[model samples]
Target: MSITERLSRGFVIFDGGLGTMLHSRGLSAGVLPETWNITHPEIVTEVHREYVRSGAEVVSANTFGANRLKYGAKAGEFCLENIIRAGICCAKAAVGDTGALVALDVGPLGKVVGWPGGVGFEEAVGYFSETIRIGAEAGADFVLVETMNDIYELKAAVLAAKEACDLPVVATVVFDASGRMMSGSNPAAVVALLEGLGVAALGMNCSLGPEQMKNILPEMQKYASVPVVVQPNAGMPHLEDRKTVYDVSPAEYATHMREMARAGARGLGGCCGTTPEYIRKLVGALEGITPRPITEKKLTMISSATHALVIGEQPLLVGERINPTGKKWIKEALLAGEYSEIAEEGALQADAGADILDVNAGLPGIDEAEALKTIITELQMITKLPLQIDTSDPAAMEAALRVCCGVPLINSVSGKTESLSAILPLAKKYGGVLVGLTLDDDGIPTDVAGRLRVAEKIISEAQKHGIDPKNIVIDPLAMSVCADPDAALTTLKTVATLSASGKRTLLGISNVSFGLPMRDSLNASFFTMALFAGLSVAIVNPNSAELQKAYRAYLALSGLDENFSEYIDFAARRAAGGEAAS
Candidate 1:
């Protein structure tokens, strides 16, 4: 079966805590290196057999620190290829082709990459390349990059594995007690970066315990398009008899596993101090339980005038009409320095059921940053709908993001290097959500693939800066149908692609109807199409009844409304208030 298929049917159980298991088998950790697989193949194969007997569907080979860099000059003499091959051969022998997969475990190179620590990117990549090539040549089914802290180094490992072989790569990072990597890379940022690199799976391993892993799991799943894997330690380690002991029993470990699985883990296993009994109990606890698939196309975290509307568990329709781009009255008011009109427009959108309001004040002959600040301050006083700070000016975006309470989304960066370089640091500094436009300095792409390429580049760049993909919103530029008949469909395709990348999507919805007759009908139709294509947010006039209706219908149809109670109650309220004119 394909890896996807195996993962889809409940959690894939990987072997647990090899170091401890080896120690239990009378191997001295400080003296006998795991690389002895080349010299003493029988001893390595015994440990593999024990894990297999304990019900491990996948057993990792004993090549964790067998790389040339770790072993130095002895690596060439000891034969790294033979060591890796012997480990995998031992693992396969233990499983006996019972359909078990062998993973070649590659640990860190024990050096920081880029700045401060001095390991250059090219050198880091080279080290991983050699390790991956040796592992692949030894017939390992997958290369497991585990316990990474620095994202730059993780990127190096991923790129190397992709270049070295065709085997799937699973990249995992270890987070410290601070809920961020030792290098300050958070789970969301890790998922965004590694997923963009096309790793087979992304997750946390060898962290605190199931409880801490549970806390990080939701945040990780929020941005992950790929399956999430978790292998928490049995519990915090305690010293007894001059050896580390884990307090959580197999049953207790299984309890945590159930919780992690409920939080949306697709693959579950144990890290340090766990054994086959722990795996058995975990598999048993999850026997009859099926995890609910994450179906939300776009997940968003909102900060409203009253409360934040994070758009994963429910649908959040952020009204995008307060901007003065095409609206003549809005533009005229801004030009006239009439701030009240903009505030009233924002209030009107909230009254018309906007969950969040996107505020923009970009116009000729105006202090964009000052105008944005004034509008945001006034809007906060009038309505509780969260504000999406929409502006091309970094000064303006930063100005709004600083004083804005709660998490706010910045209008965007594009595929262009300058925008990413300039805006991403701001997004990271202020903890701001970002909207990445699917266009570069060369302008928007004309085809779905081109749009996806641009979107991928944006996602990749955002990840490099340690920004969460959950916080990055992708806007595939929506063009007008009067100019190109396929504009709407192409935009939809781009939205779908962005959703599949596990990033939220935003579009200026009314752009599809520009210079066209019966614009409202076109706008509504386009909104519905975008929703069907997984458009999470639309920059459109929320005051329009047709557009609002289209959004409501889309939410109900998407199953986000749950039993249609919200839609029915809304329709009923509109009818009772004589607002059912539509």
Candidate 2:
């Protein structure tokens, strides 16, 4: 059976930290452990055999720091491929025909992108590809990429694995005490991106022990559709008679490991400072415990560098004024390559109560691709609100998606063959909460059922390309009520249709009130109706007082707000002529 199949059966065991074990066996602190694959093959083989004997079902090869970029000039005469091959040879020898797998281990480049100390994304991808190719050729059954903190680097490594070999890949990231990765990816953000990228399994590893892992598991379990992996450190390191020791004993570690298993972790292992005894005890504690069944998470999450916004939990207002459709100043700024105006717009929208900022720099005079990259990078630096990469050009979309620090919401893909062919691959490759416009090659669907068919078609096509339906937010194409009096009703019915099928729905709510008198009142009323119809996200101008009041009222009426506080405050602020009273 494949590792994924075995994972579905029960908790699968992986070996513990190789670095600490090597340190006890006379390996120095700063020495690259991959060097020992060539220098001391017996010691490497012995470590693998000990883990197998201790009940480890997967023994990771001693190639954690084995990439060419870091070790190429440092390993003297031992080439990168030879060292990786040796590491795999030891793992294979130890496991023998016991059905235990040998996973070729890969670690971070210890580099950050666009910084003085980091390498480019493609460079990182090339380095990982070389090592992964070597490990696959050496007969490793799996590829385990661990200790990742940077999402971009993780993306590079994962892409390399999928490009280099057919091995099942499992990715584990290191999180801080604040329960976020180094690049500001929270558990939900990490899960949304990695699962979108199609890893066999995903989880947290290293930096924290079992207690912290327990706190972090709920977020992972909420978003992860795949088998969740949890390989935490035994405990924080402490000094004992000039020797480093972990605080958690094997029994205590196993106790918490059992709790994690019961909580829903199907893959269990250890990180720094753990040993064979840790795995042995963990396996014993979880001997008869069944793996938690995986469930589909109904969340529409989009993220920026520092935060994630889950659309369905509450009404999310996406600032739609960033597009240069009618904004003369914004259009001129985009044409002049002056993003200061664009940056100010983002800040203003964020201040006015927008949860996400919809970015579009598609002016006729500017290069949309370059404009998107610049705007995405700058806007993320200015505000914490996640961005909706709004564009019709595939090149602009791909460019923006690649540079975004977190999983953005790409707007959009449609049921049209040309659109699916162009955008679905980008969504799968770059990872996003892709917006599916409910229109096809034939044009905007005239009725609710037609729009629902297009939305369903978009979901079906996305899944065919390995993109999760949960990652898609459908837009039911709200036409102007002035043009067709029934358009508003049609959109609301379509929203209900998609919501009934467990799909998140978004709408440009203001479009419904176009060319109508008292536009704000019409827009706000239409928005309330859409909310009642299960609208997950509303792309609108947050500067409108009526819309903001409507949003606060909806929160209170839906019981999402506590004590009618938001509605009360909005009424007070409105009564005070939008002025704050100190």
Candidate 3:
């Protein structure tokens, strides 16, 4: 069956663990199971046939670790291409005419990508490319990337699948018992990142039992608009007679699987400690049970590797002190190639209640792309706040997007044809939360209606490029009130209009106060007006005490700050002569 059909049908069931069954057949530990596809094709075929007979609609091939990184032809006895080709052959032979689909199973390269001197992104892509290409040619139905512990390496594998073939790509990351990846990606962040990248399905698998998986599925369901695949382990593994065995029996495992299906696990399967009996029991238990409906969440979110920042949940603050604009210290740091100074700015904003950091490396006469890469890498090292990569240069923007550790905000795509053409593809490829400035080639509008027209155009172009409206944040283009007396009013009107239609609105609030005396005073007041007018995100200096007080008060009044804690903390800091922003 095609992947499109598999995803469309609610409650599609997949096969259980092959490694568990293989080990029971005396497959030695420390011996790669992928080699069995060639050396003992009969045993592998029978194992797949048992799962297919037990009602598995989709079976992943025995090629999870068959990539060159683990089984290079020069380093191992088996050739990588030969092993992958044989793996597909074994699964296809098992299915025969049973109408079961074969998925090319892919896994991580066993190394993290975003460490200081770890494997690079492109290098990880190269490792997955050859194996995936061979699998596609050998007639695998789709690519199933599972057991991913790091979000960066997971992204690399998906990019390879998209580039290698037209097969559908489904990804599943392993969350610990705490419901976070080893790299600190939580369920919401994983769902936000994968759904934005257009995965056929995405969810949790491995490193956790069914009970542990149940703890994190609610958060995944809240943000995911696509199918959620759940492949929990049978239970925690333990040593039984020096062999690994799971605690939960097949019957008990089915009970948890049934609950997961009702909780929105449309694609159900088994991981590490499960077997064909587990799949058989799960299928039988879920019989006649209607699957949970998948709904469009319409959440506007961006993330770092650690935290997912949801817009409209609270007053979203994009820290604006990292740019070289009007900041002499930043300009000096950029010119002197002192990246530590740039990183320090992001750290300070993060400590001062900034939800995201706005990174700009657009200094004149420098290689903006290289400067942006350096700035992005350093900022990611210093803080977990998602970055807003602010650059007009397309090359610099792409460079920054490539290096960002998680979901970043791209600043920005405009209504101009030139801007959309260059940026939409990058956003689509890298899956960043895109900021769309509502200004066309005709320039900033003089009135609210004109700017609204530009906003509509930006959304239209973004959808045409396959970007969801949820991923597009509309910036109403805050103009200086000194240039036009009604500029702030016009921007406010546009924000109110867009927010009413459920569009996320962002504003560079400092621009509204430009050319005015006592800028911070005007900025704080104007920011309050914009917040009341439904502004979702604001680019501002987070260290300003006036702005902090305004935001804290707003949160308390709006019921976002639980029990007035944030406002109380801010007041206590000021009363004690402590820096409110610090």
Candidate 4:
């Protein structure tokens, strides 16, 4: 059976760390393991055979650091290509007729991708694509992108693997004991983005041993829709007699491996300090265990480079005052290239209880692309809140999405064919949560059902391009309640219907009160109604006391603000004429 088919059957076993074994065989520190594939092919084959004897169902090639970025220039001609070819050949020779699979091992580039003045997105893609191409040409059965920390680099590697060949791709990242990647992506955020990219499996590897992995397994199991892979180190490294040592023993490691399988890990392996004995015992320990059945998790979230803002836990308030619509000061600042002014606005909103700041630089005459990039880059440095990339220009959207430094929420794509075609690719490419406008080429739908149909059409189009519904937030076009008395009713009905169907819904709450008296009261009242209708997020002015009061009241009533602490605190501060509670 293929690797994907076997994953559904039961636990799939991968080999232990090659570096640990190589060190025992007199391999020096800091030397590339791929070099041994060429100089001592017999040693490489021997290591693979040991894993096969220990019952490793999948043997990873010793090519983790064999890319051109590392092996070229200083190395001789055909160094990278020859090393990868030999690595695959060594695994095949060792596992001949043993029913074991060979995985082309890929690792990170040792540098951050998409940082300011760092490796560009396509440059990083090219780096992994070249390595994947060599492995595919050398006839590997699977591609394992391991030890990834940055989500952007992970995206480039996965995209490269898919484009380079039609092999099953398994991705795992390094997480600290606190259960976050080095890039600040928590387990839920990583699962959402990686699953949206269509990886065959997702999990955590390295940094910690089996015991620490057990702590992170629940989070991965909670969000991962695909098979979960866990490849922890034998234990954290410590010094013993001037040498490195791992704390966990073979039997202890085996026991924890059993626990990991019980916690829903279908794919198990070892990282640093593990050897054939550990794998042998792990295989024996999991003999009668069954892997957890895959469950589809429909969590809606967006993130900055470090934090994920989960929607639907409570009503999320997206601060919508940063747009250059009627804000003369913001527009003038953008024209003058004064990003500190924009950053100040974002900082103020973050203090005022905004979960996300909506950033738009669509001035009439200026370069929207440059302005959006400038503002997004600076705003991220100022506030920890995730920014919503609000733009009508596809160029600006793509530019901002590429360099925005986190998983942003794209302000919109519409039901119009041109809009969907233009924006969905960027969303899919960059992995952003999309706000889909429920209107078509025929114009705004006056009735709730018509708007619902438009939403369905947009979702269908998005799926055709392989975008997940979890990454989509439907906006049912909040028309002005003053112009059409039934407009708010239609929008609220759409919100209630969509939310019940497991779709995330957002509403531009201020639009419902256009041209009305005491607009803040109208907006606040309608905002409360939308929350009752299960609205996941609202785009409104966070600076408005009326809207914030309504939000805090909903949270207290809905049991979101624990013990009504936020509500009571805000009430006391307001009565004392102190600064408002954010």
Badly placed stretches (over 4 Å) of model 3 are 73-77, 578-582
lDDT of 1: 0.77
lDDT value, residue 326 of candidate 2: 88
**Residue 61, model 2: Cα distance from true site in angstroms:** 1.6
lDDT measured at residue 376 in model 4 versus the true structure, 0 to 100: 82
State the lDDT at 343 in candidate 3: 94
Residues 1-582 of candidate 1: C-alpha lDDT, one tens digit per residue: 545567766678788888877777666757545565766678778777877777788888887776767665664536666677777788878878677788888888877665455676567778888878988887788888888876667767887788789888888889886678776666655764565456778898996887777887887887776788888999899999999999889998899889888878887888899988888888888877777684433445555323445554543566777777668998988888898778988888877887778888989899988888778767755665667888888888877765454456678899998898989888775555688888898888899999888888887888898865777778889899999999988889888887776667888888898899999999999888877777777776767878878877877988778898878877887788788635
Q: Which candidate, 3 or 4, would have the higher TM-score against the true structure? A: 3
What TM-score quantifies how close candidate 3 is to the native fold?
0.96
Q: How many clashes show up per model?
A: 2, 0, 0, 0
lDDT of 3 by residue, 1-582 (tens): 576566667788899999999988879989999999988999999999999999998989999998877776444448888899999999999999988889999988877786766788778888888889999999999999999998878878888888788899999999988888988889888887787667899988888889889889998998888889999999999998987889989999999989988888888889999999999999998988888778988888898877798888777999999999888888888899998888998999999889999999888868889888888878877788988999999988887877777788899989899998999999988888888898899998888888889888988888888888888899998889998888898899999999899889999989987887998898998999999899999999998888888888888888888999888888887878755444
lDDT of 2 by residue, 1-582 (tens): 777887878789989999889888999877778889888988989998999999999999998988887668755458887888989998899889888999999998767754446786668888999999999999998899999988768878887898899988899998898888888878877776677667899998999998888889988898888899989998898899998889999999999999999999999999889999999999899978877788877666777655677778887999998999989999888988999778889999998889899999888878999998888767866787788999999999988887776778899998899999999999987788989998999999899889988988999999898877888999998899899999999999999888887889999988888897899999999999999989999999999988987888889989999998877877787778856533
Q: Which regions of candidate 1 are displaced past 4 Å? A: 75-77, 294-582
Please provide TM-scores, in order, for all candidate models, with all chains considered together: 0.56, 0.92, 0.96, 0.92
Candidates in order have lDDT scores of 0.77, 0.87, 0.88, 0.87
Q: Tell me the spans in candidate 4 whose CA falls farther than 4 Å from its real position.
A: 115-122, 162-165, 404-406, 573-582
Q: Give the clashing pairs for model 4.
A: none
